[model samples]
Target: MTTAYISRPASAPLVGIGWMVAAGLCFVGMTVLIKSVGAALPAAQTAVLRFALGLPFLLPMLPALARVRLTPSHWKLLSLRAVLHSAGVGLWFFAIARIPLGEVTAINYLNPIWVTVGAALLMGERLPPRRLAAVAAAFIGALVVLRPGLREIDPGHVAMMGTAMLIASGYLVVKRLSEDLPAEVIVAMMSLMVPLGLLPFALPVWQTPGATELILLFAAAGLGTAGHYTMTRAFAAAPLTVTQPVTFLQLVWAVAVGALLFGEPVDPFTLLGGAIIMGAVIFITWREARARRAAIAAAPDALLSRSASGPAARGSSRG
Candidate 1:
């Protein structure tokens, strides 16, 4: 089967950038809410509530969900992905509650590195030399940020790293599913599945949240949902290379928010490490885009050659 990778129109890059910026802002807002409300809520409970709150927004997609065709294999994959995602979110909530918001966000940038490794090992995708170098550089940057020997490593840091690994695994599953399923169907299933996965974990530690905490959690749910939707739209509008760089803005926003709102001082090490990581990710994305473009450019010649051979072979056979 032929695979078509759509290239956006020239004008769409700007629109994608706008959506990415909005997504960054929404993500920062959600992080802030998580940090605030997490003080009074259990991590698992908060995760469950966040997904529960977001479910209403997805209710309209039920008809679309019903139309999706799924096999037992698909359901198994979906369940695995959901479990990974729920665990990741729970760990993230726990990490944010204990660590500085800026540090947590910086650590989360490790996701791309995890994605690179996962794709190579799990998907059997070849990692070009440049991407391999990029991954190495990103890991060095993470080490700089953590400075394991120089500073005391907190459990929160470990949790964030685990979060990155699990989330990256879930993303790989999404990539596989996207080959056969609509993006909406994948998202809708996730919306339903994560909560169900978290319900048992949440029930054990559930405490009645006050009015303010409830509102904050709901607000977080809204921001997180909006961010994901906008980010997806941005990717659809433009190539990954074009939109991925825009996400670096989230680190800046996270640092600023942490400093201003929570009085968490800016750490130069974190900023430098984050910049390095993002730079590597951007380079990797650019290389991938170039490779795809080359492939797309050559496809027409390939098709023409095949067509030319077909007619000549038929004539020879007839003669």
Candidate 2:
């Protein structure tokens, strides 16, 4: 039996971090294009278009997809994850169109915190006091960003909150499916299934996209898909703990994009809040790493469970 993670080559962490940085740049570019498009189309339709346009990228993986023979449980989890992902993507599109780019990216830092809370409350995991405090601190960070009572809460803010929670729930299901399935299969299945899930919602609000809109959407889709690929490569290179911290760098880009592209001012509260939530995420991930190491020590030669969530680690930030 092999370990969950093998010995790394020299500079593996740096290499993994380099890929993570590349992925971040891709995601930032995708977000800029999506925001540039604004709300030209309904969120559901926009989401469907992005995924539908992204279909061709999956073509090369057709053989790998064809070889899969999933049990009923796998189908259930995949379907469930797709549905959650569909909703999350729609909400994300809507939110990004309406909110400041930096704020959108900042709020996204809460995705992992949602998963941590979900595990404890829904999955019966023990959330020791420290983890519990971290969750509380994460929420405080969110409040700082939102500042609900101090100002009128935008519908976009509401949508983004739902986006984080929904996507995190999907990650939970992805975790189950990932155990026996390869990451490629999991990603491909999600790519194919999410559009189908979004179809019903997209139909009512569908508007024919213009040439310029189509070209921009296609570009955004390509970048987003590429980001997912590079993120997966980062995971394959090193553990989540190493790449996870690198994600905070995206906030820097988002802030720059917001200021330089959209004229959105730099909000210090958003920056501080993002940092706080990022710290909580790093803490949670560090703990997860410790737990995995202890488990490996207890059973050194056990078959490694394929962690289903390398890209999911960044969880819809690619949008």
Best-performing candidate as measured by TM-score: 1
Model 2 agreement with the true structure over 228-306: per-residue lDDT tens digits: 9899889888888999999999998999889998999999888989989998998989998999889867663342222
Whole-structure CA lDDT of model 2: 0.89
Q: Give the per-residue lDDT of model 1 (tens digit) for 135-203.
A: 999988888888999999999999998999999999999999888888778989998999899899989
Q: How well does each candidate superpose onto the true structure, as a TM-score?
A: 0.94, 0.89
Report residue 154 deviation for candidate 2 (angstroms). 0.4
Please give the distance, in angstroms, between residue 144's alpha carbon in candidate 2 and its true position after superposition.
0.6
Model 2 ranges with Cα > 4 A deviation: 1-11, 298-319
| lDDT values, one for every candidate | 0.89, 0.89
